[model samples]
Target: MTLLRDLPLSALRALAAAARTGSLTRAADELGVTPGAVGHQLRQLEDRLGVKLVSREGNGIALTRIAEAALPDIDRGFDALASGLRRLRFERRADTFTIAADPSFSSLWLAPRLDRVRAALGRLDVRIVLSIALDSMLEEGIDLAISYRKSSARDLASADLFTERVIPACAPALIGSRSDRDGAGMLDRLPLLHIDQTMGDDVYPTWGNWFTAAGGQRKNIDHGSRFPLTVLAAQAAISGMGALLASELVLREHFRSGQLIEIAREVPALTIRRRLVWPVDGPKARHAAAVAAALAATAIAEADGPWPTKS
Candidate 1:
């Protein structure tokens, strides 16, 4: 190991390839070099190590027991080096355009409008991540984030995109019918689909909260099955399982497509301000800011809702 510090790696690489393939010709073919060049490198390596580790047998070469034993580790070292280079290359590409986003918003909201975003940004390599909250934006080498958490760090800049505006929406079929022409009141034994954000950074409203907000009283707030994400709950509601107090921000498509109808106009739910966050004066800051503006404009264009306007 100590002798290898100053030695040129090309010779060692030739030895490994020759030993692996059992022939200098095959090694040279793998390395895109002549058999003579491979033999010469092997000679140089043996001279540097001060040992006859390779025995020439025509086009084939045989290694000593110790050198043969070392081949596996040497191969592993080369593999690790190659992996490191690949990681560096990926980091370079990822740093150009990477975005972290809340799972619900990313899956339900932003995913559908990605075409619009791509069209607006134009000539982009975008990566929108739906993952957990990190200790820092730079930890994952993220250029930006569309998150429920606002940035207050000195190194980061954020713009308030929208406030959480949850509303009760359910399948069109679930509402009142038969003799009750209008969907005015709650159905008999209406199954409430609860959102379980127990591990999340923010707490969302329960069925109890919405009922209270609507100036009514309801029991068994914890009756229904709970889902971790609003998008999942919305899907359940869309499937006619029950009503979901969903956010209008992400469920705009469902509401528009008539898969889900508003059981109520709006309800006071667990409110959290979502922000477009990025490193202040970063290499991608300009791009991030441009992305934020494009997204906001897109959201505004979709419908008149909760996006804040310039004063």
Candidate 2:
């Protein structure tokens, strides 16, 4: 309630730590200070507030009723201050990278390659935000965005990572029940689960598009069920809700495992390329390049076949 500038922040922090841990020594250890230093701060804080903050016993300390009541508010204030400082420090760190990506790309592609990234770049801190909002990356805070794009945008310094390719997918049970061997022909009988883009910023790659690309017709294009994300649509397919036009990058392992059947591998290619994009002249550009290289290499290796097979 008082003016923040008038409060002794360091002493309040020490009081909060001591109240939380119930011991000056433990709190001191956490703060990287000596027990005596912690005690001095606590004493200073109590003197400033004109209250006995802690009751000292044999080896431990207990907060007084007044201390207990005031500590929650004090701790909350300290926590908010600490969080702000952390964000400031993170923003200042030149090596720390933040990436904005689609949910499917984050889960299917980048997440699998994180180990390779860690091994290549020692202890690099990456903050991955699930988004297709390119505007967020152009803002001050976001460093880069790895996204599925049909072409490069003028605002972004972009490099191609990999193409977004789709294959017909359904649960193993659904595939087994079908009489046809070719996946494309089965679309007429089965419902096609659609993944509608929630933001309307990204276009949904559909079975009809793939079918037409592969020299088939969209006469049997089914739009029985819809989901917001490809991952959710794939899950619905896996549960036998309907067939899904899913990315090969995402469905590779599932297809090999027999969890989901690839209705047709030779279907038309509705491929979209992934791009590592950032503001043309920003500090994040180099970091985005490094990440793009690492991610591209991973995607290439995975796309080589010998994918995860049914055990």
Candidate 3:
């Protein structure tokens, strides 16, 4: 055995192959070696063990009883070895998916629900990048994207997942103190907050826009404290920092908990459809479909209303 150890592993491999295949010629073809070479290794092995491992058959060969008895164990060991290598490769590539979305939605809407996604897809590692840039759909590495817009452009296939309605929300205490007063004029007295730092052509609804849409006198819309993200603006509203024009999609829980109050249903609250956007001809569309379905279920569950079918 020590002398055999001094020889190449290819010799043992030939024996295993011949045992399983039951033919020296077939083993040689599979191993990319000549039949004579395989026969030579078998003869060397049989001589070393003082046993007949294989016998000749009409222009071919067959494994002996000893070879037949050893084959099952040898095949099981090789299968396990192959499976282990495959598992290692799968684990190494596990953390490869990346998704991007609006910063506010990422923080307020998706961040809170990621644990469920993680538990559902335990094997795939995920990375979320907060981006207000509209170019994420064109970015090379992003596998999925979420954004708020009225209509999807022709360049991208956007599925409307939910509608984000802008409403005047403030701390319940703030609303309670002013309950007796005319709620429409409350914005003139209370400080307001804004999130307008994103560099894009997309126009978000503002207080003045809502006022004009309602056929009311336009007030100073730009006189409020500005924040860069919707979640932060909502937090400011929750802490009584000021009344914020924020999305109903992100503030539904706060409204339910009485932490925040929706003031004056007359704001004609702008409803912009939130969408899952992806390249029209890319591989990400299938990935986008899964996200779209999850978001659709979330929307229907949270809204307590029939969701409009997506086009």
lDDT by residue for model 2 (1-311), tens: 57456878778778878877889999999888999999999888778778898989779899889988987787788688879987787666666777777777688767767877764444557778766566655554566677665335566676777776667778877765344635557776777898776432266566667777767675547558988787888888889998888777778767776778766554655676667776666765656666667777876886776754522
**Residue 32: error of model 1 in Å?**
43
Lowest lDDT sum, 10 consecutive residues, model 2, at 197-206
Rank order by TM-score, top first?
Answer: 2, 1, 3
The reply for model 3, stretches above 4 Å from the true place, is 1-95, 115-123, 150-155, 175-182, 197-201, 282-284, 305-311
Per-prediction TM-score to the true structure, in the order listed: 0.59, 0.62, 0.58
Give lDDT tens digits, candidate 1, residues 212-266. 7667766676788788877788889999998887677767778777787766443
Q: What is the lDDT of residue 100 in candidate 2?
A: 74
Error of 2 at 243 (Å): 0.6
Best by TM-score: 2
Clashing pairs in model 2, backbone N/Cα/C closer than 3 A: 164-272, 183-263
Better of 1 and 3 by lDDT: 1
Q: lDDT scores for all predictions?
A: 0.72, 0.72, 0.69
